[model samples]
Target: MKHCGKGVFLRPMSCDIKGVENLSVGDGTLIPKGCTFYCTRAELRIGKKVIFGPKPTIITGDHRIDIVGKHIIDVTDAEKLPDQDAPVVIEDGCWIGANVTILKGVTIGKGSVIAAGAVVTRSCDPYSIIGGIPAKLIKMRFTPEQIKEHEKILNER
Candidate 1:
C-alpha cells in the first residue's frame, strides 16, 4: 500500500493485489476479505469511511488485445502494457456491494452505494444508488435537503 490513513483494515491474506504501492486508502475504510485491486499500471484511491462487501474487484488496466499477430499473454513487457492503463478513484463514504467490478478511470462519487454484482464501467454522481452490469443510476440515496444534512454530519465526524 502506498498510503493508509487511520482505521484502515483489510484481510491482506485473503486479498489479491498486484500493485500494492498503487493502493492508497483513506481513514476508516474497511475492505473485506477476497477483494482485489489489479493496479499494475495505475493507482487506486479509496477514500475515507468507504465500506466494501465481499469479493469486490477494482482494476486499473486491461490486457492489450490489439497487438497484431500476437496474443495478449505474449505481449512484450507484459507487466507494463501501457496502452490502456488509467487510475481509479473511489470517493469518500461509498458502499461497494458484493461482487462489484469497478474498471479503470472510473470515479465513484462521494457517498454512493453500488449494488451487488454490478459492473461499473463509467463514473457516477455523489449519493447515487447504482446497479446492474455496466451500472446505471438506480436512484439518489437521499433528498437534496437530506444530503446537505448528511454532509454536515460527516464533516463533524
Candidate 2:
C-alpha cells in the first residue's frame, strides 16, 4: 500500500502492490489480508469506499504471446511483442469477494459486487452483481428508481 487515500485500512500482509507509483487507492478503502496488486507498467485506480476480501489479485499487465517457435521469455525485445499493459479502474463502493482475480483494462462501475473466486476480464455496469469464473453480470444491486433515490441521498450529504 504505497499510495492510499485518507482512512484507508490495509490489514497486515494483505497487499503486495507492485509498481507502487502506478497504484492509487482512494479514501475509506478496506483491503484485507492476502490481496495482491500487480501494476507493473500499468495504472490501477481504485475509488472511494471499496472493500476487498481476502486473497484478491488485481493484475494490470500481462506478457504478450505473438512469436512462433520462440519461448515468451526468450523474446527480449519488448517492442516486438503485443501490448498487454492496460489500466484497471474500480469505481466507488465496489465489493470484491475473496480470491477474485481482476485482469487488465477492466473498469468495475460503482457499487458493483464481485462474487468470490470470480475472474473478471471485462468492464461491469454500475451497481451490478457479478459472479462465476468469467464474472458475468448476475443482476443489478438496485432498480433504476432505487439507484436514483440512493444517489439523491448521497448528494444531500
Candidate 3:
C-alpha cells in the first residue's frame, strides 16, 4: 500500500492509495483490509481514532450523466467517461461499517456511526448515526445536554 505521509495504518493485503498527498492520521486509527481510499485531486482529512471496516469504498468522483436523449450509447462507452471529482471529508472518531460506499463531496461529521452497506450521498451532522441505501440520520449519539457538555469540554481544550 502507498502511504502519502506518516500515521496511516494499512492491514495485510490492503489496496494501495493513489493520488493522495499531505495526509495525517491521528493516534489510534485503524484501516482494515480491502478498503480503497482514493483522494484524486482532493484532500481527505481524517481525524483521530477513526475506524474503518473492511471493504469500505470511499470515492471522490462522480460522472455526469447529462447526455440528453438520442445520444444514447452502450454501457461500456458510458463507463469510459470522465468523472467530476470532489473532496470527501470524514471527521474524527467516525465508525464506518463494512462495504459502505461514501460518494463524492460528502463530509461525515465527527463522532458519527455509519452502518454497513449504506450509500452516503450528502453531508451528515456531528454525533449522528446514519444507515441504509441512501444514508439517513437514524438517531443522535448524544442528548442535548450531553452535547452541550462535550462542547464545553472541547472549548476548554
Candidate 4:
C-alpha cells in the first residue's frame, strides 16, 4: 500500500497484505475481499482500473530450498537462507477472476482476462483470454482490426 491512487477500494479486514510498503495499487482498481498479497522481498504492482475478484493470491516470494541439511520450512537462520523473490506486475485494465493464483515474476499484460481458478505461472500477451491450471492463452479478446479500433476509441475518450 505504498502508492494507492484515487478511487481505489481495498476492503478492510478482508484482504491480507504482508510487506505493505512494497506494494502499489493504481487508480480505480478494486480489490475484493479474501485477497492475499505477500511482497516480502519484491514489489507487487497493480496498474490502473484493474479488477481482482475474491480469493486471489499474489505471491512475490517462495520458500528457500537451497539451504542444505534442513527442509525449506526448517531453516532457522533468516540471513543464511533468504527466500527467493521476484516482482509481480498486473498491467492496466485487466480482469483477474476469483480463486486465481499469480506467482512471482509474472507480468500479466494489459487488458488481459485471467479466468477463475487459474494458476498464472508465466506472462501473457495483452488482451489475451487466459485459463487453466498453468494458465494458457485461450484466445485474444478481439481481432487485430478490432483491437486497433478499440484502442482508437479508448484514446479518444
| lDDT of each candidate versus the true structure | 0.92, 0.88, 0.76, 0.90
- Give the poorly placed runs of model 1, Cα more than 4 Å off: 77-83
C-alpha RMSD values across all candidates: 1.7, 2.0, 4.5, 2.0
Predicted model with the maximum lDDT: 1
Determine the backbone clash count of candidate 4: 0
Q: Which stretches of candidate 2 lie over 4 Å from their true place?
A: 1-3, 11-14, 80-82
RMSD of 4: 2.0
Q: Once model 3 is optimally superposed onto the true structure by TM-score, how far is the C-alpha of residue 155 displaced, in angstroms? A: 7.1
Scored by lDDT, model 3 comes in at: 0.76
Candidate 1, residues 1-46, lDDT tens digits: the string is 7999999998899999889999999999999999988986689999
- lDDT (tens digit, per residue) of candidate 3 on 105-129: 8999998999999999999999999
Query: Which one wins on TM-score?
Result: 1
**TM-score between candidate 1 and the true structure:** 0.93
lDDT tens string, model 4, 1-157?
A: 6899999999859888899999999999999989999986789999999998889999987776676687867864364334367899999999999999999989999899999999999999999999999999999999989989988998998
Least lDDT summed over 10 consecutive residues: which range in candidate 3? 70-79
Worst 10 residues of 1 by lDDT: 75-84
Q: What lDDT score goes with residue 54 in model 3?
A: 80
- What TM-score fits each model? 0.93, 0.90, 0.76, 0.92
> What does candidate 3 score in Cα RMSD to the true structure?
4.5
